[model samples]
Target: MSSKARHSLDPLNLDRFNHEALIPLVSPLTGKNYIGWCNHIELLLTATVKLDFITGKCERPTERAKAEQWDLVDSMVRSLILGSVSKEIAQHFIHAKTAKSLWEEIKGRYGSHGPLLYRIHRKLRSIRQGNADLFEYYSKLCNLWSELHYLKPIPVCKCKCNVGKEISVGECNGCILAKQIADDKSETELFQFLMGLNDCYDNVRDLILLMEPLPTPSKAYSMLLGVETMRELSKGEKGCEKTHDLVCSYCKKIGHTHEGCFKLHPKTKRSM
Candidate 1:
């Protein structure tokens, strides 16, 4: 009678299911990785169309034949749950006959940590670039942002909203205000990223913020990357020019000076 009822009747789904090859190497649920494991396993279940099993959205049928098929599908999803977590966690939930029960039990045991949320927020606020390169620093911020977002999902209404659709920049005239609001939300991250950047990039950071329309975080990254590349190229060219001016009075070599002539002092060199 339901979508799962029809979907469970298909033996091809079970026959084609390959758990070993499909399981990602995510952290175990027993560790401090409930978020990562939860997100990863949900994606796998969603892709396989078995998400309903754990979500408890589908009811069991009254007919024995249909109920048996439902149990078979539930068993498959249960196996997926067991395989993802640590052996201890798997053993603890061994008696949870249904996938939904197992999933809820696991969530109850580990998902509601108040300290983790606070810790993540503190880490985000205190994050600094330090000695890490731009790419590395940006990647760290992105990873934290992703986890933070997962914990507190952004609320956006897509119903009859043009901004929710794939309408290009100017084409989104109707939802211009909506789009601007969404864009404004991301400015927090952009400002945070810019603040964490090395002070040497103060000029470029100011230049980026001065743009009329304002740039997205990624656009800012590219602009700063261009400036960084130019600075590196300039330094390299200066180093090359200084190297080219070297000349040895002893060996008459362009690369070595008289005091640093290898021929004059075989074991030790000097530069004039």
Candidate 2:
């Protein structure tokens, strides 16, 4: 067999499969779209970990066998990574020999912790539920939160407390930091969401803030939603009321019967 043909048959040669056959097509990760695209690719790579493609774990192997397996896994990962990106980006890293090198190249060019944090903060500030659907507004905020979490993952406390006894809730350093962050974020998020609210909600928002323990972000959302619903209901009731309340031209009073109206019945006319 030809050397080229033999390489195609190798178990790790992902290129042999049609691009769509191995992994679904996703949009290229341009600098502008890097955050969401990176998130999606990261999840795909995580799932692929179980197949021994990520870390290339081999329990036992001879010197040459292990090396070949690692090379095969790297080839597969590189192919998948290149396949998912735009041709322009792919061309830039076309010569990259390993998945790790390509990954680092992309991260170096596009990912910067400082700028990402600033952008996230700006997004959080500008976001408002506004005329948009409530669920969509909440989902957009959630996506931002997820990206922020990825950029700065919360640390887990590993120290044992009370010598094997399970640590009580809220006692760990991680929990304290997480709660503080959440509390701070909640204040900003609640205000952003409130600012976008219709003017009719001004009173409701004021009332919410005045409460002893101001509502959590989720509770505030619920209260605002309820207020919106009631406003809609009140508007509908007023419309119905307008239709039912009929004032007599002559009697100048509502619910005036024909028998009581001097204009309609001259015989029942009264002095001016």
Candidate 3:
């Protein structure tokens, strides 16, 4: 095989996989954040095609040679599990015989479902846009939604029958799609987003709702940004103007951007 072909075949060359680089941990996993940490590790392993080693889908071969290879792969996965966690936590599971055992030990200790899931739901409900910017509030809510989805993913519909014609309409609506799919009003992200905003946004909220199909939370946010800008201008709160931050591509100087540079727009400059 050519060198390039050989390289392609060995994509999962164990030495090439850097645990920290692949996992992107802000800090080593602490017991409190086991869910988020496990999510990251799962993605990394699945991408590398080594998930089965840790998931117990790949069993050890009875043949001596194959069993030895299996042990080597299991050790690598076990090392990855250890490297991902804090040193203190790693001590407890370092002696596990298989990667799956280590993973289960961590999950069994910290992955208590009933109480943790309840807290996640409660926290999701408690979030609001009060006293925060629209973008900031949206980010917080979406992040929690993301983490929740990862922990308990909704089942994928793998129907062989294609619905033929696309059924897309005003997905921008305040969760018409949610009502149809989930058949629950509370499951609507759009509804949750709109209802969370402060009373100061009541007029804009009404305008958003009056539309035939309500604007998406994102579209509503953009509209609200316009309103926020108008409100700021009305209060004489002019936003920061980074005039010096701009650089002219033509003249290579501060004070004007490439589009506004006098050299680039000579005719307009002359007219001015």
Top TM-score prediction, candidate number: 1
For model 1, the local distance difference test gives 0.72
Best by lDDT: 1
Clashing residue pairs in candidate 3 (N, C-alpha, C atoms within 3 angstroms): none
Candidate no. 2 TM-score: 0.65
RMSD of candidates 1 onward, in order:
11.4, 13.1, 10.2
> Mind giving the per-residue lDDT tens digits that candidate 3 earns over 108-136?
98888876688778877888876677778
For model 1, the superposed segments whose C-alpha errors exceed 4 Å read: 1-12, 162-181, 237-272
TM-score of each: 0.72, 0.65, 0.68
Model 1 clash pairs? 259-270, 259-271, 259-272, 260-270, 260-271
Weakest lDDT window of 10 consecutive positions for candidate 3: 160-169
What does the lDDT read for residue 156 in candidate 1?
Answer: 48
Lowest lDDT sum, 10 consecutive residues, model 2, at 238-247
lDDT of each: 0.72, 0.63, 0.67
lDDT tens digits by residue: candidate 1, 51-139: 77888876677899888888887887888788888997788889997999999999888887576688777988999988888889999
